[model samples]
Target: MLRNVATVIWDGVAPFEFGVVCEAFGLDRSDDGVPLLEFGICAPQPGLVRTSLGFGIEVVDGLGRLEEADLVCVPAMRRGDPLPDGVTEALWRAHDRGARLLTVCSGAFALGEAGLLDGRECTTHWKYTDQLSARFPEAKVVPEVLYVDSGQIITSAGTAAGLDACLHIWRQEYGAAVASAVARRMVVPPQRDGGQAQFISRPVPEIDAETLGPLLAWISAHLHEELDVDSLARQVLMSPRTFARRFRAETGATPYAWITAQRVRRAEEMLERTERPVEWIAGEVGFGNAAALRHHFTRVRGLSPQAYRRRFACGESAESA
Candidate 1:
């Protein structure tokens, strides 16, 4: 039922985030049995808008285009950028008319400025989650997830997560088959688990846990082995209790959790790049069997191993391209 997508842009807009919105709704995929939408780019000023990377693009449409769109998307904006009052009024008017609103990255800040994020469950990029929470006390900021779809308003994390959020919308409106088709063209996973936490840099490297970094790297390399806190602790020459404490303090997750997360990440790479069978991938990534791999993969990615392979595997598409 969703159609007529509009992307709003402003000065200091991030180009890649804007492109994510465009890729989701702007494509002419009618030949592939996908719906074609009336996608347009709009800005309040209706002229040149500068990108965060010091580039400029001409905006041919003005705010009037948003009046006709069934969905409005806002891309990431530069931190501390001034959001014009007209943009907020346009957003409110679109939402009042039952248009779905979505924001990517720091663009949530613009929604926060518009008062739309008030008392709503939302998220921005992980690095900026604290700032967003501090700026809007009424809004619930979920930092760990890739995106949040609170029905009418969808907010995503950083750059690549915007693609995830957009694929989620495609899956919701057009079904998995259609979403998979679009994602195949885009060369990204058709759907990713929104609840899956982003793999942060040393996700939690404080608390003098820097020594655990090398151990994590080792586990990432040898995911095929059966691993446990006790064994891992032995490698670091610490007691199991002390190692568990240090692991949680450093990575914000247990040994099992961190290992499963990394295994899932490895499986994803193989799923996308190789034509290998699920059973083989399971063993290769330490899941031991297809069923276990499927369980953990689904828990982390919101889709089955076979389903992910079908949707993302570079099979016929990669060779033909």
Candidate 2:
């Protein structure tokens, strides 16, 4: 149903993230049976735009091209640049015409500035969560998720999370089959729930190289087991306090939080790939029971596992037939 898409670009754009949007939507993957997305890249001025990394990108279209698009995408911006004056007006016009608006990373700042996110649930990169909340108190900013889709407006976290949001749009517009095929061609996961926490720095003590790698691997493999800091510390021949310190330094997260995230990731994979009962899957993923899994899954993914499974896996049976 997405017949045409326009990506808005500006000076000091993050090239790789900008390219991710183009790669996902601009290319024709019809040979692989994927629906073609009519894509156009536009800038405020129809000329060369300087990237944050000191490179020039030649964009041929200007903001006028966005007038007829079914969707408008805004890529991440450099840290502190002011948005163009007319750009927000152009976006407001597009929204008034009923076009969907999307943003990747700091691109949400533009949406916030345009007054589109007021009284809506939205998200941006965790690094800017506080700033976004402070700047737009009327907008509900969810910092932990990979992305947020509030009907007509969609926003995502940093870099790779942009890919997830794009694929989500594909799934919503077409279906999971098409989104999965596109994801396969790109060699990325088709869906990652947006609510996963951004990995942040912790304050663990340093461990010697000889024992660290094996210990970490062992913990990952035994996630289904009862893993307390004390037991893990014993395996690495360190006190609980010392192990906690080292984990923070090495992984940029506490051991407990990291373990929970890994378990949730596994649960998501099962929800997409298998038709097991939620209660059983919860126990298998080390949540101990279904209620605990539902709590954490909702907290981390912004949806119950059942709701996510229904969205992505519902049509599988029909397709298989």
Candidate 3:
């Protein structure tokens, strides 16, 4: 049902974040059977708007365009730049008329300024989540996820997460077949759950001789083994308690969580590249059985193993195939 879309910009807009909305909604995908949206870019005044990267974009539509939009988008803007006059009022009008509002990165700040985020769960780029929370005490800021869709408002984390959110909307509005088609054209995964971590485990050092780096690499390669805290502790010559504490400190996740996440990632590769059965893959990835694999894969990737394989196997689209 989302047919009309508009993005409002201000001085000092981030080009990449703005482009996310344009690519998702502004592009004509009618040739692929995706519905064409009436998309437009608007500003407080119709003219050239300065970008954060020292470039400018000519926006020909004014705030009035948002009146007819089914969805209104706001992209990242410089932190300290003043919100254009009437921006908040325009947002309020759009919301009052039942149009969904979406924000990418620091664009949530504009919604915060408009008081639209009050009593709503929202998110922004991880770098600004704390500031968004501090500035808007009533807004529930979920910092660790890729995006948050709270009914009438949607807020996404930094950069590429915006595309994830847009795909989610497409899937909701047009079904998975249509969404997958759009994603195929964009050359991205058809679906990435919003619950997925905004920041996954940081890359471990490849050649560290004096840290847990070597053990971490070994764990990845030996994912088929029954990895437990005590065994891992023994491998690193540390007590279980000490190893657990240090692993959490270094990886920002518990040993169990980290290992489980890695196993899911490995399973994803197997699903994408091989025609392996789910039970076999589960055992190879240390899940022991297909049930456990399905549970964790669904929780982490928001899809069943079979569904993931269907969508991604052999690097071909399930629909097309």
Q: Mind giving the per-residue lDDT tens digits that candidate 1 earns over 1-321?
A: 788999999899999999989888898988987889889999999899999999998999999899999889999998687786489899999999999999999999999999999989999888999999998999999997889988799999988899989988886665556777888888996656576565544555566645687898899899999999889999999999989877866665678887887788788767767777788888999999988998998866677877776665555642211
Off by over 4 Å in 2: 1-5, 23-38, 52-55, 64-71, 78-82, 93-109, 116-207, 210-213, 318-321
Please say which candidate is ahead in lDDT: 2 or 3: 3
Give the per-residue lDDT digits (tens) of candidate 2, residues 1-321: 688999999998888879878988999899987878789999999899998898999999989989979999999886466778689899999999999988999999888888899999999988899999999899999876788989899999888889989988886766556777899999997766555445534333335344366877777677678888999899888899988877766655678887897787677667766788888888888898889999998886667888878765644752110
lDDT (tens digit, per residue) of candidate 3 on 1-321: 899999999899999999999999999999998899999999998899999998899999999999999999999988666688999899999999999999999999989988999999999998899999999999999987889989889999989899999988886566565777789999997766676667645345346424677898999999999999999999888999988877866665779988897898788777766777888899999999999999998886667888777765655543211
Candidate 1 minimal-lDDT segment of 10 residues: 312-321
At residue 272, give the lDDT of candidate 3: 67
1 against 2, candidate with superior lDDT = 1
Candidate 2 or 1, higher TM-score = 2
C-alpha local distance difference test of each model: 0.84, 0.82, 0.86
lDDT of 1 at 281: 86
Give the TM-score (vs. native) of candidate 2: 0.68
* Prediction 1 TM-score vs. true: 0.66
Candidate 1 residue runs with Cα over 4 Å from true position: 200-321
Name the lDDT value of residue 63 in candidate 2: 94
